[model samples]
Target chain A: MKEFKVLMVDDEEDFVRTLDERMQMRNVDTSVALSGEEAMKKLEEDPPDVLLVDLKMPGMDGMEVLRRAREAYPGVQVVMLTGHGSEADEAEARRLGVFDYLRKPVPLDQLMRTLKAAYKKKIEQAMVAASFAEEGDFESAREIMTGNTKKK
Target chain B: MNESLFMGKVTAAMTHEIKNVLAIIRESAGLAQDLLAMAGDSGFAHKEKFLRVMDKIDKQVERGAEIVTRLNTFAHVPDHEIRREDLSSVLDEMLILSHKLSRLSGVNFTVGKGSTSVVLEADPMKTRMTIYRLLEFLTPLVGKGSEIQLKAMKNSHGLPSLGLIIKTASLENFCIDGILADPEWNSLEMEFGSENAAIEPSPERDSFVIHFV
Candidate 1:
């Protein structure tokens, strides 16, 4: 069983504090940042395996944060969190290459499940990339890592 | 801090606080209306309590409205100036706010029956906040089950100004040995005291008064 590190961002201090405490209790390694800039700083210093980002913030909202995170930390899986579960939100997040979108106030089980799905995606991608590199296939491995997936 | 940023925080907090008050008042008033509609038909019990709750809810809505108006007035106070203004409206607004705090006071509140709106010009918001702090200061003195009274009347206005009399059995001298009694109030007093406003205690009467200049 592999442990995954997750970066979480939100502007509301109380909300961030409570969620951090709960996620830590569930054996998830979490690092918190108040804004997207702070999240990027944390990622650049020590990129987490997964990121859980909140939708609303004072400045530099979630979409812009996601764009920056993906550009800087290509390997990290991004999961966008919103306060709504509307179809429009899901479609937009999907278009942005988000691994998963969880609506708030989400049930505890649903959040854990979404994190698990994202973690599984990362693991599967890592395994394939590793196999490609083992066969002296550098180009194929880089493609996999960069989400290109050099298919036959 | 930037004025807009500061305003945003104040507006957000005030809006949320007033909204909860509105919701509670609506629920209680609606309950009273529903009870009245049913009393004519189902011979329901607790009809009196429902009516009482309806009256209480109206009082609450009035208080909530005053809070919003005070916030608006606070928003409009021109940069430091003293002139003639109606004090009655200010006192009425403060009383409404105190009722919101003291509906559970189970205690009595009084107003000196007068036909005049004691006029004074000062920072209305800070004045309200000071009065608010006084209410906050008094509430815990009498604990939850005590009564409080507030009165406003014209003073000589020659040397002193309009008198806002607050009577509370629970308004203790509860001193803060080193610091000001209330930062919210004491700070405003310190800043604005240069204008000659004074808070005097009536030695014989169980009351304290703020004569706003």
Candidate 2:
């Protein structure tokens, strides 16, 4: 099995630390950022397969982080893990192409399942883009990789 | 905002923080369980006891999360000054929130599973307070080891109401008449009256009806 890399961004230090440990135990390569700014910096440094982000933070909220990541690294999938989220926030997250929306104190098994699904999605998209590139259709490959082409 | 609304905002924020705490505890316990699995048989001592402890931690975290989630929902009750809310669901939440008070006052609180859509158009905060005050007045008179059943009902007038029945093996020291005459009950009645609601008691059946307009 391929190791799935995940970047978990939450302002709660203890939660991020413990979750990081648990995800590592499950054979996932997990990294943590204490704030949305730090998460963006980490994204720039090394983009992971899935970005597990919290909706609320002291500065540069998760929605902003998600927006910037979507603009800069369209390939990375995002999953919102929020303690305080309203229906409007969830709708905005969905509109922004979030892979999943989950509430806090979620069971680890459920979280793992979502992460796996998101990782699989990221891998499948990458594989499709690679296939198009190998077929010498660079424009189609770029369109697929950047999510500019609608699925048929 | 009124006092209740202000307090609701504060409580809602705290519940979010509590959720984060519960999540951390859950993840830490999960990590311990995962490590134990990797440790295998010979690598650890008292493995069974350790696993049991981990299981207890997981269970407690789940219980705590459930309580906090309910509290979070309750904390948001005052957000709407007046709204259409299901009476049965409100009573269900009040039952859980009042569990500790019932236990301490030596009363058992039970809510009957009624029609799910018994909704009322009223002030959410006032509705909760009315039910809470009724329980407060009844618990002491009902005495310890008494059973109380609360049911959401649609009254004869086609309005949503709450029915509270108290059953005691012995009513020796319990006086329903005196409880009804109490100043607190009078004040609660006045408050309910202001909300276009009424609190009435049936001495024959040892029950109370909270009628909402």
What C-alpha lDDT do the candidate models reach, one value each? Answer: 0.64, 0.86
lDDT, model 2, position A66: 88
Scanning candidate 1 chain B in windows of ten residues, the lowest lDDT window is B171-180
Model 2 clash pairs? none
DockQ top scorer = 2
Clash count (model 1, backbone only)? 1
Full-model lDDT, candidate 2: 0.86
Q: Per-prediction RMSD in angstroms? A: 18.5, 3.1
Among incorrect, acceptable, medium and high, the docking class of model 2 is medium
DockQ, candidate 2, vs. native dimer: 0.72
Q: Write one digit per residue (lDDT tens) for candidate 2, span A35-60.
A: 99999999999999999999999999
TM-score per candidate, in order?
Answer: 0.41, 0.87
CAPRI class assigned to model 1? incorrect
Which segments of model 2 are wrong by more than 4 Å? A124-152, B170-178, B181-183, B202-204
